[model samples]
Target: MASENDYINYEMQKRTEPLLGVVIHNDASELNANEWREVLINAPEERYVQGIAHYYIDRNGQWQAIDTENIAWHTANQIGNEQYLGYEVLESLSSTDEEFLLNEQETFRVIASDMIDYNLEPNRDTVKLHLEFSETECPHRSFEIHTNWKTTVDGIPDEWVINDLKDYFISQIKQYMLN
Candidate 1:
């Protein structure tokens, strides 16, 4: 297994584009965070793209890894790779359990935090799925999971659904701060 220290020193190239927004992804691996880190350390250059997400949310809704400033190699087809921040919520074997819901909430919280930190808008245009840039089904499972949660949850206005799920999550963050 790669030590925590080994995963900290990635020599990412400086980004040419100004930070625009956030892109969410699912790692699609069965490995947990530590195992994923070890695989990333040992994987070939071609596999580095999988390791490109700036942040990774573990199964427990905890922030396992973060690299906010440096540009990661997450998005493919050269889309949004440099222009947006990226996060990967581990979904190798995720299910719609309480743990997954908590993890999803943490994912939203981190995205909200990044939105504040980067001065970006908190809407569909800014907070996006990897599929928006690529043809892949990345984060589709997670997205569907959250979409269902929205329909079932109370207090979230129906109008919020048209705006985008990020808006709902942002509202949740606001509510969390108030309480």
Candidate 2:
């Protein structure tokens, strides 16, 4: 009852709306491309959750991208899921800060290239974080590595919000675009 091209069909999860922005997330685990591909296909347990991770940087510091034409069920919100590509940066399994930062930098470079292809600019509107769409701590490692903010009494961040993260990522994307 299913085929490999089932999701590839335009009627399935294809992107209908014009390309808008990008949502950055941290996978929180280290999985290879084949492992990630399997996760993407079988991880759609939640209702209508596509479970697709559109972009990421492998542990080898290589940028990887999935089906960009299809709408990734990444963002919990429909708007983001339909309009933007969700990028997942592989987290450091050994908790190495430098390795994680390097992974993020590779991701940023790929994202910057995608922005150029989509004719998008590095700004608040075009750059987004997973926390903005839902209450998840996605992009967590990225936030922690880039900023000194830690969880507060609310069990979430206080001083640093999505804007701070967005600004930092936007600046990074901009820097990559210059190279």
Best by TM-score: 2
lDDT of 2: 0.70
Model 1 segments more than 4 A misplaced: 1-9, 59-66, 148-166, 173-179
* lDDT of candidate 2 over 1-179, digit per residue (tens): 11122231222367889988899988867774445545554333462354555765654643233477777778888888889888877754544888777767877888998898999998998888887777777777766667655433234565346678788889999999999
lDDT of 2 at 64: 37
Q: What is the C-alpha lDDT of each candidate?
A: 0.61, 0.70
The local lDDT score (0 to 100) that residue 67 gets in candidate 2 is 70
Task: Return the lDDT, model 2, position 85.
Answer: 84
Best by lDDT: 2
- All candidates' TM-scores? 0.73, 0.80
Tens-digit per-residue lDDT, 1-179, candidate 1 = 22133443446777777887888777666555565565565566666755467766664533333356666777774648887888777753655556556656667676777677777766567776676676665664454566653322332224344345556555664554343
